[model samples]
Target: AQSVAQPEDQVNVAEGNPLTVKCTYSVSGNPYLFWYVQYPNRGLQFLLKYITGDNLVKGSYGFEAEFNKSQTSFHLKKPSALVSDSALYFCAVRDVVGYSTLTFGKGTMLLVSP
Candidate 1:
């Protein structure tokens, strides 16, 4: 089965507003969760990761994520967002026993309007 899934195709928010990008995962043992943002024609920038310990993890660019063991979910959240925050976001999980590469979701586009 695929490791991670992002339910939303896109999330729209006005500039200076908060935003959330939903994500869920299925992995053996403790999952290595990571959130990345991709701008057009650019590589994905690592935002945050939840390797172990602490359900609530903070990250770059005023972003954070909550890891829910019961629900097998990790959702990304940002407060007081900016238009610069608008980008294609991807949630990924490292393999339990495979290569070091991570499995990514389809991606959720966050559009911060003016």
Candidate 2:
């Protein structure tokens, strides 16, 4: 089985500050990790993915995530926060060595205050 955990239910940041959303996962083998953001009443938008390569992966809208194999963690980061970035974020994981569907965390609502 594969699962993801987002310890924080919400992350608040002031505009122009950095932001982070934590995530951890458990999988049978090497994992495929992903981060997505969903605006109110909108579908999930792919943020970034960690398949294989440098542990640090960058993606859309100034978002990046680090894949730490030993810790089984993939935490999302943004250098600077923006009000528009406020949304629901999700961390997902899938087992690379096995046939399985992706499992997503409950979600983390990021509130960027102006």
Candidate 3:
């Protein structure tokens, strides 16, 4: 299978604190990376993606991910998180597909408390 891993099962942060969700991956060809955030009872919302260009990819909701080709890592980062930012975050890689099928990790729950 296409290789991908999220090391953290969950992350907790106080309100207005910075937060990060770690991710690592591997693929045969050039990789396309994506990050998604999921709220309860809602579908995965596309946060961002690393398509064919720059290493630092910015996304919605003040989120950004840095794609490291050498390390095979794409870590999600946000400065000064809010309580509303708490959700399940997923890091994905584009596996063999025409529609960019995302191979997701088990997910890391971000608990932001005030």
Across 1-114, the per-residue lDDT of candidate 1 in tens digits comes to 448999999899998887889999987666889999999999989999998889999999899999998999999998888989989999998855555678899999999999
What range of 10 consecutive residues in model 2 has the weakest lDDT sum?
93-102
For candidate 2, write residues 1-114 as lDDT tens digits: 889999999999999999999999999889999999999999999999999989999999999999999999999999999999999999999898858888999999999999
Q: Estimate each model's TM-score.
A: 0.92, 0.98, 0.92
How would you encode candidate 3's per-residue C-alpha lDDT over 11-102 as one tens digit per residue? 99998888999999978777888899999999999999998778999999999999998999999999889999999999989854455567
Name the best candidate (by lDDT).
2
The models' CA-based lDDT, in order, is 0.90, 0.96, 0.89
How would the candidate models be sorted by lDDT, starting from the highest? 2, 1, 3
Give the winner by TM-score. 2
